[model samples]
Target chain A: MTDALQTDPRLLVLAQGDNIAVLKATIKAGEDILIAGNEVHVGSTLGLGHKLAVVAIQGGDDVVKYGFPIGFAVADIPLGAHVHVHNLASRYTTVEIME
Target chain B: MPEMMAWPRQDGRKGIRNVVLVAYLVECAHHVCKQIARPFDESDVQVIGFSGCFPSEYGQDMMTALCTHPNVGAVQLVSLGCENFKKSQLAESVRASGRPVNVVTIQEAGGTAAAVEAGRAWVAQTRAELQNLPMVAMQPSELVIGTICGGSDATSGITGNPAAGVAFDRLVSEGATCIFEETGELIGCEHVMAERAATDALRPAIVDTVAKAARYYADMGYGSFSNGNATGGLSTIEEKSLGAYAKSGQSQICGILRPAQRPATGGLYLLDVVPDGPPKHGFPNINDNAEIIELISCGAHAVIFVTGRGSVVGSAISPVLKVCANPETFTHMSGDMDVNAGRILDGGGQLHDVGTEIYEKLVALGAGARTASEALGHVEFVLTYKSQSPSNPACYPN
Candidate 1:
């Protein structure tokens, strides 16, 4: 395993064999992130410590964290797009968004 | 099957760590107890205590639970001579559990200087005995973990809290014990929480506990749901409660645990934080650290702390894994937080990914890896007297 791959600036994999990667720092819209040898543009301006999809996801897809589904995507999210209330909804109950 | 690890005590119950706990019998003896624990410095000798002048059955019960907590292998009881605390009963209960226990009264032992010296010697011996004990392999099923989110904001509900819930689900499914507490914060979601209870009897108990918290806080001239919560973007208590409830991870509520009470079996349990009666006690939990201390007394091996505004406090006995939900807060307080659930809010990661990371971190901690708080030596602990009758036989089948 390459040390560069493990400490990549764009994404951090906390556990081995996990499907998702956490952003180490924010990526502005149109910023490119290299994951799995592919570079994808940042769809929305993600704040520092925010999340972006490392892989393409379809509408109604359940977003997985800690290896379990926390909620579902409200819209189709392209690779490297921000994943928050704008694109996701809690599976248990509805939440209000201010703004 | 999930693997398990345990430190076998003289008693049959398995522990994750062999700890020597120094306990202050009353608020009066706290200084001396702290002095004794200070010398051991990272030797697993944690200081925990009861801060009551007048004797209460609840105080004695909590002391007994803490002294004999699974993580604790030995105990030193520090007393100030004229207190009404039943030090004998407290010592006996711990000794009966087959753990080493010592009681030293400052007045009888020739005051502060003499007591500190004697207490230090005792701590050295306890630590010596604890160090050589075999470290057994522990499993996820053997762990009793607790979750509490303090200083919450809107991001807490959306990100860190739900991420914790995802982790809780995985642990419970693996036969690990998990507890989620703070009935006051859970006021809005009691109905939803009750629906997940293992039995119909527990459903009403769940609702009643939140109602009790509401009344208790209301009598104190402020709602238990704080104004800071609103400043952090929470509109109503229900909104906060709904978010706080996510930490339970959709597991069936197994049983209700009183402060410092261990579950008879592994699964998800709700801790009832409200006092049994009116506002005799000033506040149910004075602060976040008090809540964390109570969970430790109930035998939690560690805790998952979710926050949006950012809480830096940790417990004395159990290691706290801080999960930051607000991306901005995570940026500012990155050193203090262990997991950045806020990434989910920024669209960098999904809930399940963070949840799995937290679960794996929990396992790693159980395997003896130090958490951010543990590595930073944030061993904060507090205990105070509050009254509560035993749970109804129907609620907790002994």
Candidate 2:
């Protein structure tokens, strides 16, 4: 890998102890980046501000961000996987996504 | 010390802008009021009103607060004569504030044409009289600022909202009264906020207010989470709340303010935008402008609006500084934005850098520099029916 590509940081961890990190910019599938001491390959294209798991989250586990649990995972979510409405559900209010 | 030359009001408040407010009593008189104010620039003559034909104690209080707002130099009330809003009583309240007040009823004035003519004549004269309003030296401690995050995306928490929080912290430390609202959006951060309360009694008040919002939204079968919020990558209400909560900064929240109620001292406060009872109103706020109007009614001289999805709405009586959170959205809607907090996320600046920029811009705004929305004539205003009782004294221990 080139020096510029290796040095660029793509994910932003808002606070310590946050299990998920936000994407600083859009990234295409197959891009490998180091997160939490692990180099994880991107499984799919993710847009800016979208969340990615810094650590593997099991089914029914809480998705933590800003050092607080934002929601619980509906299913098992692997590290570097996208965390969104599909696998996450609100702890307070239901996110009724229209099909 | 941050200070500016501001318009001094009889109520002992300072206003960043001296405005001639043309207020319509009901939806029936809206067109006439609009036509009356159409001839003048929005900066000089701005139209604001309540649309409900039925009487609402909440609506009445909001109108009274808005019409007597320090920013309003004079007011002209347009009434349809049949609506339940007591126009004469409103006129009396406006007069009591030591401002010139006029009322024109469409039924008594012979209809739309005559009413519009009378309203325009009054507004024209009021505009002339507003030119001689005294400008006094005002400090940051004398200012009341409000903040709201609309069209939020994930960028809001990390970039825009946190930057705004920095600005709020600075303003609060300077002894300026700073308010942050939209309790419906703060569904899951109640405990976090409670910990930041100034007094022990305020903890329950803060916790109870968020619970009220959670229950209200549950009954309505909706949280404040919109499709745009999800599309922008916010998955749930709790997730959005965590992000929105960052806008409050780390200051000790001194009090909780209900709509149309002013804070007695300069400090950090939380505004409960949701109604007191169950979901009587469709939503806590119909849109961002409603919350902005609520903040203005409580005496915000200017509002700091943090947006990730890029909201362009401004207020009639107060200035709205749009802090765009997403770098991509800022690139697309630069004309509508003031501060580019997105730069922090883009690796161009630190969070404190953007926060300081917002703080400086607000101080400049107080010195008569118009916000991007204000300069673009985005005078969007809204007020609807909602019920709220007086706040508990415990919430304001100071």
Candidate 3:
């Protein structure tokens, strides 16, 4: 099992082989991060429960949740960038963002 | 696989109980039906009715479905002489399903007193024969279960809903029929849900149903997603919908059913609670109990209800298993809850552990064990008039 309590202060992977890890606490840019056994610099700050991709994702790439595709990335999301409604759009029904 | 028990009916369907049903055809016949059902004094012989005077194809269809439901072994129809609800047709449908059925009219029998006496005798005889029916092995695949969440708070989305989602995933994998409803609660997440459809054809229906719900609630001068929702810390309807959608687990969306429409196959099916067009008879469902009635009409054997603020209500025909998600609410209202998914939030248990507990409880209930609601004799049921066009041809095979 992946360590539930990892050395990283911000995020933890819930399941092994998962492409994304959940932020355990708010993370800031330029922080040292360990994801999928690799050390990388945080690209951006992210809130708790928000997702951070272990690898870089390009525009129109599918975002998986619960190991299934929930939506697609609307723009290129760097590794450790906060992944949520802002960067992702549902592939099924139109979601109009309120300005 | 472990062997499961069931009440085998003559019609080839199996049930956990062999119930004798007393049905009221209209509002006027309700009292007589209740009085007649009283003599049986057993949960297996329960009274269920529709209180409408006008003719409704929907009402007729639901009545037939309930009267011949797998759990029902026989039926008695109560009618007032002047109502448009056709007592003969209703009784005929039940009889044709291979169940014994009879009808008694207050006007013909002289009054309520006489009709009640006649109805009581008929019920007694039917109950005797129904008790003798053979028990058979019921597989998990034959079970039809429904789920709904009410009295929701922030904790609902985080714990209880996802826990139920875990149970839904297990049940669907076993080939059990699972249904989750309330499109109004699912306003913002429709696009995400539509993507899970089993086919490309069902995608539009998914969008249309959510659109229909949005328009219906908008016309009422309120968002189907409520302000109380915001107070509960749910920022938008879409966010609330993401939580509500969690109840379906990670299964493929099999099909869509309107109120009382049974699914063609077992899996995760969505029940569209919104009316087809404009609101006709007030709100789609007055409250949670009304939603429960729709679940029963769709042939659910039981319901798994998730709540955060606390809900003490339970349904009549089917058993209700209450799951409490908030640690504080669970502490305050422990008596009302059957499972404490909130334990996970308290760091006392894991989500998978609580989910496994719920799944085992469902299996026991499906094997003739009575839930707290069923033991309390809370067999609350109701049917109201609403219109629906037949399902689209592309949605089902002919």
Candidate 4:
């Protein structure tokens, strides 16, 4: 990570209870980030406005954001891994209507 | 504070702008209505329509509410003569409001061109009548304010909506009636909002409305069912909701209102946009402007529209104050945006500052400032079918 990353904010932490942080810019794999006094390596291509796992999430665990539950992780999401639909599923299920 | 002047209506309501509206009763009359409004070449002359031919209770209610909108000084209804839009009901309500209304049926008026010419003369005459009505000074207690977030992105949660929330706080504190809607977008926020309810009875309705919004979205999902989750910011409904809920500020939700229903008095109110009974079989809001139109129907003189992805929509009667949440998007679409709440993310300012900016912009708008969309001639209005539950006293216990 460059020294510029220390002075400038690249990731946003919305709430203290949120378990994820959003990237302000697109991040490439192997890039280093400093957040919440911890230095972590980016594990995948994290797109802008996309969520990053700030903490470990076991399978079926809730993915917390903005101090509330956004969804559940479908897989064991490692810290620094990309958090998206591939690993997360909506907590609310769709209701089917008969024609 | 500068004293704001506004168009005075018969029902003790004030309008931020004096707009002569040409309403198309159905899709067929839309073009003729547009032509009728074209020659005026003025922002105050606007066209709005309900595209559906089959009459809907909610649609009729919206048309009546819109015709009686405080900003609308007069109305010209363009009817195809075959559709069941109930022009008589609309005309009666508009006339009762003491506003001059002209109904031109294409079948009776020879054709489209003849109807347009007739509408033009009626519009000119109505303009003269509107000039005679008294213009009064608007006070905070007399103002009806509304806020909505559109095309929200990641930055919206921390910046745009929260700033709007702060502005809402100031408005509510100033004794101005404030409203925020889109219960569907507030899936995860029912509990928090209900807890802030002024009346204990309104709490359950708040929760129930959120549930209805969720069910409606769930039932109306696309075949692939990726409803804006692809936006790369929001992963689930709750995440997007948390962002949406921020727009209410910290004001106690004094009451709840159905679509097109005005508040009984001035305070913080929640507009429940979810279909009340059996589903309406159509989208709750066809677009952002539909919600804006509903706010206008509720007598909102000015609308503060916060957008992160940059929506350029503005309403016909009421002026919209566009507050951009994403700085990058603001930089890209600055021409469409009025205030840059994105400055918080760009490190130029804070949420409270953006809130103050929004509050000032709204005051200026009410004082006759032309928004970017209004200056550029973007009067995007839409109304679709939606049903509501039986009205409850709890919805408006003043």
Name the better of 1 and 4 by lDDT.
Answer: 4
lDDT of 4 by residue, B202-285 (tens): 889789888877777768772322445456556665666777888898889988888778898888998877776555557878
DockQ of each: 0.05, 0.60, 0.10, 0.31
Q: Which ten residues in a row have the lowest lDDT in candidate 1 chain B?
A: B229-238
lDDT of 1 by residue, B321-354 (tens): 9999888899999889899988875658888999
Q: Provide candidate 3's TM-score on chain A.
A: 0.68
lDDT tens string, model 3, B1-398?
Answer: 34668777666667766788888888899999889988665576788888999898888888887887877788888898899987788888787888899889899999999999999998888888877777888887888888999988766766788889889889899998899988877876777788889888888888898888878877876555455544443333455577777788878888888776777778888888777878776677778988987887788877899998898777766778989977788899887788898777566677788778788888787665677666666777766777754766565322
In candidate 3, stretches whose alpha carbon ends up further than 4 angstroms from where it belongs are A1-3, A6-99
Per-residue C-alpha lDDT of model 4 across residues A1-99, encoded as one tens digit per residue: 343355227666666677787776677888887654457787777666788887788999988876667779999998767787778877765312222
Give residue B175's lDDT in candidate 1 (0 to 100). 91
Best lDDT among the predictions, by candidate number: 2
Least well predicted 10-residue stretch by lDDT in candidate 2 chain A: A1-10
lDDT of 2 by residue, B2-91 (tens): 568888888898888888988999999999999999999999899999899988899899999999998889999999999999888889
lDDT of 2 by residue, A24-89 (tens): 888889888777567778888887778999789999999998778898999999987899999999
> Best-fitting candidate, measured by DockQ?
2
